[model samples]
Target: MPGVTDNRKSVLITGCSPGGIGNSLAREFHQSNLRVLATARDAANIADLAELGIETLSLVVDDLESVKACFADVETRLGDKGLDYLWPKYVNNVEDTKYYTVPAMEVEISEVRKTFETNLFAVITMCQTFLPLLIKAKGTIVQVGSVAGIIPYVFGSVYNASKAALHSFSDTLRVELAPFGVHVTTIVTGGVQSRIARTQRTLLPNSMYTPIESEYSRRVTHSQHNAMPHDAYARSVVAQVLYGPAPWRWLWPWAKGRKAWIWEGHRSWLIWFLLARGRPIAAAFKAATGPSVQSRLAMQQKRNLSIHEYLSARLLKTYGIGVPNGEVARSGEEAEAVAKSIGNDDMVIKAQVLAGGRGKGHFDNGLKGGVRVIYSPTEAKMFANQMIGHKLITKQTGAAGRDCNSVLICERKFARREFYLAILMDRALQTPIIVSSSQGGMDIEAVAKENPEAITTTPIDINTGVTDEIARTIAIDLGFSEQCIEEAKTTIQNLYKVFMERDATQIEINPLSETSDHQVLAMDAKLGFDENAEFRQKEVFSWRDHSQEDADELDGDIGCLVNGAGLAMATMDIIKLNGGSPANFLDVGGGATPAAIKSAFELITSDPKVSAIFVNIFGGIVRCDAIAQGLINVVQEMGLRTPIVARLQGTNMEQAHKLINESGLKIFSMEDLQNAAEKSVQFSKVVKMAREIDVGVEFTLDI
Candidate 1:
């Protein structure tokens, strides 16, 4: 009112509470010598601005009568001078209700209405009520918008929709107000530090997102960290409004200009570029919610459980199936004693490693072969000494060979005919099937690939099992000798019994031999049992050789801990796509607890080649916050030096992120898959470079 008759300009700013963009903007405008009218729902909220000599008014933007009264008051104070600038900046208050972050289906309809009314309807009403005064002064209308309107972030659907509608409204208003000599500017704000998210937030009691409820508070305050300061944002916005390009230039007959859509705050430019280029934001979203790698690994583990040759032979003997007289020995002296007890002139000593191609494989202890024929007990001891307590590297073993803790000594049997016989689960038919082949003592996979017709398959009904007729048919098809036909048929029936009783997924006897003595024997056996049946098959499960299992170390630079097989593959694929090498694929499983998380970290860190670790988990059956806390504990307990990039989604993901951030560890929490992958690769390279430099220094010192 005091500056009404003066030459100074005037601005009416709403939602100008302390520590907000509007409050800072009001002060900035006043510092520039303009008459400022800062308004809040409660005048006491803007008392700090009032103390700075700025006029404060109590106005509720959503209340129609309050908007009209405020307009009348401004009209009376300004008289013919009118208002030079109209700024409406208001958002739905989360403190008003606890169900603000609940899923769309669970949130109350009234809360949705309130949000729309506050963010969209209120601004439109404010603009309509003050348009006359604004037009009279040819002032600018600054509509505060947000990146949330453009980006589809989780847990703020209502707020995002309200802001999106406001954005659309501002675009239409800009075109409509061009001829009126009034300007409409939309501020597409990114992450700016503000009081909007200061209050604590919660989801509904029966929310479907309850598993991720810890994420709600984190999402509410997501912009508070590393966000542009409110004052800095205000300075940039005011500078753009007062000195940037004119909004109506595009509407003129000769000039070509567009409406002002200022993108300010952190990551604004990157988001704009991504949106403009039509990048797949949804892919990033999928990376968070995809099946966990741990779940897939659990499935893989359950489906794959095979025993060693010696154990398979022992099981065969129990079922009345003929096998070579053999004994497993952990030491060379024991192997000699077993060979001597058998009293055979010819014997075969084989390294008891899990991998195939054992006969052709070389041992780490300078043994030329894993399997060897011996003529005496002394020869058996010599070969056993070379085979035991050494690593056997085969085609299947890769460079990291399997450890051999024992050797099998058996009397060599001369076979008149060698044939392959196997009992396998036919998943498609949901039954057991017996496969027989005339070709044996060679790779079954190779035989199948090279000559599929050489194999004969016979399905067995679970109720009837392997009858005498079926066993005889398989023996005849396998080309068993006439004298050994009855023996072969009995062996086949006994093998089937072993398969069913042991819950065997597969039982293969490569070279089910017909000896010169007219005896049918399972010369070599391989058996795989169902891990799900471990409770009942306790003895079989106990025979599981952990040293035979695949190692966690992959000889790469980036260690990965993911939850699902598909997701783990995708995580690795994306890492490779981004020019980074993954060290290993370790799935912690769907029901991962803190203990499992610690174990996973320990396994990943066990690889000295790993310079960085990437943890990508989608918390479908697991709480992400629990996983996060576990990771924090592991890092602190182990004092891990490797950099970690963690991207957690679903249940309690936000809370997980909060814990990791507050833990002050080397773990980097990222929401976007691409960003997380790139950061991991970047950190890995830095660590590698540092290692190389250290190595160089060490070499120089030694010289």
Candidate 2:
């Protein structure tokens, strides 16, 4: 133990391992002229810090006795001068999906307890043990928490819960420690650059989790690469923590950082909804031995209900909602027959896929759009033949698109007036809110953004439901004609009944059309049911079109195949901000192998709408050259013609750039993010212009 030397400002940081957050912060604080005491589980682990004149100590923070002894030694050394800062920033994460995917009752109690011991109890103990020293100096306590705590994800329940508990503790500590002139601040960080890619352990094999391990692991791999660089992260964190006039909570320092994604509630909710609905959470935990675990699991598992237009239309019909007469046809002959059976009236044939923007999508076999309005049975048969058994790509379908296994032949009805209407649960109000706009089609979100006044939002009380008063108010807000008010009210009531009875999360009728005859029709219906209610609503769950989804897909024009969800989204937003449309959201992940990269390359290039592709890689555990090689292999094998703009950073960056350059392919490299994005946009525009000039869409095809 070192004895008290000078009165310089001091900071004691636990878990100062190399390539870790604590170590980075220690360096940052030391550079700021603070007397730094960096502690780790093993003194030898942080021996390098001593070279920089930092005092190092071996302290197993999770063990109470170790914590006490460490504090005692510190007390003996520092004396009454005490400690100016105490950062309890240690953490333990269980990456094994099995630990969380298993029924809570089935998971070994010891495992969960151990995680809490390190992530939660130990932090609390360290604070308790060091309180006297901190109080004497009126020091600030910085607790580094994670966003995972605030928004828990699957396979991270235990770790997320522990951090959540710690967050609560930090809040309480801030209040309790205030009277002593002591400050407590919580830094809720998102993915920050660290050695996470190297340190993340593989899932330990258990019969319960082995089968689904690969799937979940692939799902989380990109998060590691999406982390903020440690130097930048540490500097940002320390600046906030050390600056005078401390607040109870620290906002994310860099506006461009990953933390912004957490507060974008709608975006985050969409991600969660997609993940929850796509997987069978109920089946994953069916082996749980306890009834409570099973029951709770059942309740939460019924999220992410998948329903296409046909299924949704059928659901509406059940509630007496007016829908165009339609019948499912699996083949062109079937579609023609269906058309003939309906007496050859103008008809709309729509591809039966689970994605949006079908009107603007096309099939690979020269079929234009998922929806086609035709006056003849021959045209219906031709469109059906082109769509059925062909891949249909839309802005939402990514490059690969989805198989058109069926088509819906519905009578085409023209609307004299169109309006957008939807009922959805409002998180802020904790109630069902009805959103309606006089103008509608596929761009309701855009209308809501640009002309919010046109969009009326009415919050409904659960007890009153959609009463006559509420219906009249909604109809008036929608500018419904006096003659149409009663009919509109009836439609609203039926929709509300469907929403309540089916436990639906969202009911949208875009362009709830008014025909020339003045009849209201559910022209296009989209319904999302509460996934948790699937057990009770078996009929709704049965309609899930799993084929419409890939392992991952996000809507955009410029395809993004980055490594982490946060980074992937950031890239997409940046593209949009830079006047570019993202073609799809594709995360190859942190540990993507050469083969995976090749697959990703092929997938992105296959999309006709994806004029250009952007590949942003922050190689942490993944070597940059491996990614370059994958790109090269795909270009050589498939002769990819799409323009590619890549930004490669991190491990073996030089080699990665070299490999791509030497390949002599039509790939452009830019290490800077903005530069790469601009190039991708320019190239995408070029692709668009060139295709317009020539009927046969083609690029230079050479690097």
lDDT of 1: 0.72
Once fitted onto the true fold, the runs of candidate 2 whose alpha carbons sit more than 4 angstroms away are: 1-303, 551-703
lDDT of 2 at 388: 90
Please list the C-alpha lDDT of all candidates, in the order they appear: 0.72, 0.70
Off by over 4 Å in 1: 1-300, 303-306, 329-334, 426-429, 541-557, 563-566, 576-609, 619-641, 648-672, 692-703
The sequence of per-residue lDDT tens digits that candidate 2 reaches over residues 1-703 is 3456667888999988887778888998888888899998888989889889899888988889999999987887787787888988755332433343333434578868877887788889999999999989877788764545322444556666776788778767765665465667655434564333333336555645567766555533334443557776676566545531111011222322234333321123323333334432211111110001101111222236768888888888888888888888889899898888888578999998877678898888877778888887788788888899999888666688889999999998888778888887643234576878788765664463346467666667777799998888887778777788888888999999999999887788888987777788899987888767878998788887777655534445687878866566557756765678787767787776777778887788777678888988777677788778877787788877777887887657889998888777888877777678888888888878888887444434333
Q: Best candidate, TM-score-wise?
A: 1
Clashes of 1: 11
Candidate 1 scores a C-alpha RMSD against the true structure in Å of: 24.3
State the lDDT at 61 in candidate 1.
90
TM-score of model number 2: 0.44
Q: Over the stretch 533-626, how does candidate 1's per-residue lDDT look in tens digits? A: 9989999999999878765434579999988654575577567657787887677877677788889988888787888899988775678898
